[model samples]
Every structure is written in C-alpha cells, then in structure tokens.
Target: MTALGPLPPTAAVRLVKEAVQDAYADYGSEASRWLDGFTRQGGQVFCGAGCFGCCNMPIRLSLAEALIVRDALNAEKLAAVEAHARQVLANARTAPDEDVYVRRHRLEVGYCPLLDRATGQCSEYESRPTRCRDTFSAFPARYCTEGYWESLSPRDKRQYARDVARTPGTDGELHYIAPLEYLSEPVWEAAAGAMDRAFGLQVWGDFWVLVSLSARPDFMAAVEAGDGRAALKAAQAAGLSHPMILEIE
Candidate 1:
C-alpha cells in the first residue's frame, strides 16, 4: 500500500475551508429548493428575525467552519469567545453525561456567546456556521424556546399535541419545520468525509471547541506543518477531545 502523508498545515486548512464553503453553498441551494417545495405543499415557515429560541442549543461545526468564524472575529470578540469556550469546557467536564452537559450549557448560557444580547443577532451573522443558518422551527416559535420545552411534562406534551392539531394550517400534518438535520447532515458528512480522506484524520467537532483550538498559536503552527497528530494532541491538551471528536469510520 502507498503511504499517505498529511498536506502542509496551511494547505490542509485551506482545502478544508474551501470544501466546507462549497458545501455551505450547496446546502443553501438545496434548502431553498426544499423550502419552496414545502411552501408549495401549503406549509408555512414561522422562523424570522428576533426568534432565537433555538440558538441556546449546542452547535457542532467542522474545522473549516470554525476557522472561518475565528478569522472573522476582532481581537476583543475573540477574547470573549475564548472565555466563553473555557466556561463551556469546564461545564462539559463536570456534567454527569453528554445530555446533561448540553442541557446545562443551554440553560446556563441561554444564548450563543457570539449572539448580540441587545439585538438577539449573531455578531458574525454573515459568516455564521451552516448549522445556525439551517435551524428553523416547524411549530410555533414560542414552543422552540429552551425553557418551554424543558418544562414540558407528559400532560403538557399531550396538550401541545392537541393545541397543534387545532392550529390552522397544521391539521393532521407536521408544520413546516426547517428539516435542518435532514438537509444538512449529508452536507456535513460529505465535508467531513472529504477532509478525512485528504488529511488522514478525523476532522469534526463542536463549533466553539474547534474555533478555540484554531486560535492557539502552536496548534495552527502544527497544522500548518501538516502534522495531524500534533494538532490533535494540542486539541486534547485544550480539553476538546470529548463529544467534539467524531467517530473515525
């Protein structure tokens, strides 16, 4: 078998970023077509500006996406992001499990660190990750709130079903949810697959974790030199090895 070697870190990073950007563009076109189909079928989209209920959830990103986001931030914003990432990592360490950790992170943070509190907008709106751009609520926007769903009991769930059944345009049908994962998962998979094949390394993780690691001087230097193992070690040292690391298959 021929031996495979890593591309120079700079080249690898560039390839990954380009692949992800291309994937994003493809996703945009696919999502638009899907949404159009949904609308044609009498489905209505309720997501709009100022509706940030879904922003509190954990967001995963490919290395390429993280690098793009990191590069777009100014020094002050980068510092804030680093601080927030540290807190997130700390919380991740103490939680009983991944689910518990994610829920706690949502409740504690209440919004993405990059979110503008006053405007309820992403600071890097134009360059926001694909996951963020793809998220949309099929039901009423209020139901999408973290607190609202977390508070739901069995009875509440039943009542919600009843209420949804009664709502106009939703009779016996699912509301026009964004189908975020359905649409984007393939894009992510393709991007990850391409990166892995190109770099001979796993290359997917939480957005903040990846972004934080990309900011490390040594980490980037190692990556620039096409040393995947060294870059992975740097990420591990920074406490980003958990849920962030995807399966190698």
Candidate 2:
C-alpha cells in the first residue's frame, strides 16, 4: 500500500467543518425526533408560533446557549445584548432570589423583548434553550408530569411545594411548570458544555450575560446606540436586547 501523507491546513479545516456540520445534523435530527414524539404523545401540543407567552418570561439558560445567541449577533447586536445584560445584572443584584420567580411568572402578562410584537413570535428561535424546546402541552400520560402541580389542588400543591423544597433546582412559582423529569438536568448540562466547547469562551460568556441582562433597560439602551446595525450586532453579541424592559417601564 502507498504511504499516506500529511493533510494540508486548508484540507484539515474543511474536514473539521464537515465533521461539525455532520454532528450538528445528527444531533438536530435526534432532537427533532424526540420533540416530534413528545408532541404526538401529548396530542398535538403547541404554544403557537406567533404566541410569545414563553418569550416574555425571565427564562434561565445554560452558558453554552448564551454563546450561541452571542455568536448570532454581529458587532452592533453584540453591543445591544451587552447593554441589556448590564441592565438585568443591576436588577438581579437588588431583587431577592425568591422574588425573581414571582416576577418571571408575572412577566407573561407583559410583552417580551425578543418577541416581534406584530408577529408574536420570538425573533431568535434557533438559539432558544432546551427548556423552551422541551415544554409540552398539559397531557399527563404522554407528557413527563401530567398533574404534578400546586395550583390544581391545595393539598396536592402543598405536597408538591414540600417536594420541591427537597429538590434543589425545582422552582415553586405560580406559572412555572417543568415538563421533563430530574434526569434531564444532566443531559441538558452535557449538551450545554458541548456547545460551549464548540463555540469560544468569549461567545459563550457574552451570550450568558446578555440573556441575564435583558431584564434591564439602561444597559439595553447602551446597546441600541451607535449605527443601528452595528449597535444591534454589539447588543446581540452581549445578549443585551432589552426593549421589553423599556416597554414595561
């Protein structure tokens, strides 16, 4: 057999790109299959594409998700995202951690920042978190937890509250409903880590901070400054789009 030679740098880069693309395609296919199954089992559950109910909430995301959003933003978008993040950071500093849950629930009544008011759809759908992806309709058997709640029955709700207390990450908010079981935590975490490594640290941290900061107005304004396109890119890179906060104010 002929001896193999070292590949050129350009060829290697192309190979890596192909590999990444393949992996993404495979993972996306799997995720789509799972979502399809979940949707089917729950009897055709959908939040409606134009419905912005979930976008208005102060949803939490893993660091990797943050990076994906940041990378999606160009220079202008990066600035906007950063400014929004700072605003959120300011608010988070004063608010009691428990109170945040309450605020998140009420936010559904208001407009969401990422929402396109005219369309009622999230502007950034591709980069949304797994939590958003996994949310299913209120079907008990097909869905992960059908009647697991505190709102339906007082005694059941109280018991659920006690159970949540024992569970570290479980939230006890009025509109807060989780679709998946506890085991999903590790799976999502691993997915997030893989995303982080695929992107760079700068992209990841910027996305994380911006989403966290979208609750603040002052910061978002900073992002909205400069050339509109440039500002949008900067804000997006920083995860700083907080027009929703301004609307509420």
Candidate 3:
C-alpha cells in the first residue's frame, strides 16, 4: 500500500496474483480435505473435465484477472473474446437485473469464447478467470445446464431431489464444492485492494466487460494515470457499464 506510484495495470495484476497465491494454495488443500470428508458422508461432486455447461452465462471478475485473461489469449481467441463481449455488452444494455442477464446470456449469448463447442471443454482451462475457477456444481452436469433445469416442473424437481445427494442453497442451486469459493474470495479482495491502490478506484465486473476494458491501452493508460473519468467515459461509450455488467467504483 505504501509504494503505489502510478503503477501500470500489469503491475497491479502481479500484485493481485501474488497476494492470493498462498491463500489459493491453502484453499486448494483445505478443499481437498473438505471434499474427502464431504463425500465420505454420501455427498458427491458431479463437476468434471468435459462438463462445460456452466460456461454459458454472465460472470463477474476484477480488472487484474481480466488482464491475465487478455495475456493468455491468442489473436484468434482475442477476436473471439471481443465478439463474445459485444454480445454480453448488448445483453446488459436492457437487462433489468443480474438474474435476467444470467439467463439471457446463457440461452442467448451462449457459450464462453474459450469453450470448445464440440468437446464441451474450456480451451483456456489453465488460465481461466477467477469466476470460472470459483464456480463448481455438485449436481449432475445436466442440472448445471440452465435450460434443462428450467424444464423441470415443481413436482419433477421434488421427485428428483428425493433421490439426489442434494446440497441446496438459497436459490435451489446445488452446493458446488464449498471450499472452492473460499479461494476466489482472497483473489477478489487482493484485486480490489491492488486496483484501488494503483488507480485510486476499482474496476470489477462481468468477465467480458473487464476484458474489454483491459484490452484497451487507452483505458489502461487512463486508469494508470489516475484518470477515472476518461476510463469511465471510454467504457460507457462501449456500453460496458450497465450496473449488472460492471462497476468502475
């Protein structure tokens, strides 16, 4: 916090990643033990390598994570990201709330840019954003598919629940690996602190929204120079500031 003299977005990303590295590692170890204990009690984890059904939705992230994503992408994937971001941005333009945005983005905007459509796998699996890494499903992969879940009637849901090792949350969402979420929280906290110290404000939001902002050298420069207005102006012009899509505060 002491030496924050106009650091570049890249520098901020390093700070964020480094800040969370050990915490993430600890979370992984704890999560493994927790999973072992959980499954011993007849619980289950249905998320697997080929299950990319959860990828087709709106997800939030910090600018530093976005930069990691930008750096990880190739030219083709970069273009794909921009294209997907445009749809996400467009969907945000009229979305009444996050729920609507998530559903619309899932069924409308469709799969993630990095998703391998044929194999139902993430191409950038290793360097994927925090949100992607955070989300996990304890239910059958088909349950993770929003459309399939939506098609189930109330009675059908009840009947299915009777036979499943359910860990239902507030929204009937099956509890994902609970420990996985703990790891991502520190990353967000570190990213928020790093962004705040570097630019005097924080940029956090939907993954594509952050990616759009991160890829723009002008946007990056504006924030690096502590020019929030210019950065906000640029992002707004591109329709990336819908409250659901992003927050530059």
Which prediction has the highest TM-score against the true structure? Answer: 3
- lDDT of each candidate versus the true structure: 0.69, 0.42, 0.71
**TM-score for each predicted model, relative to the true structure:** 0.81, 0.48, 0.84
Per-residue lDDT of model 3, residues 56-85, tens digit only: 867778776777777777666776777788
- TM-score, model 2 to reference: 0.48
What order do you get sorting by lDDT, best first? 3, 1, 2
Residue-pair clashes per candidate: 3, 36, 0
| Tens digits of lDDT, candidate 2, 1-249 | 111122222332233233433444454666566556756665334345665444434545543344345444444444545444455545544456645633633342233345578987766777655555545333232112222342358886676556545432234432232434232455444544443343222112223353443323333333223123443454445444344322111
Report RMSD (Å) for each prediction in the order shown.
Answer: 6.3, 13.1, 5.4
Better-scoring candidate (lDDT), 1 or 3: 3
Where does candidate 1 have its weakest 10-residue lDDT segment? 1-10
| Candidate 3, position 60, lDDT | 79
Question: lDDT of candidate 2?
Answer: 0.42
RMSD in Å for candidate 2, one decimal? 13.1
In model 3, the number of clashes is 0
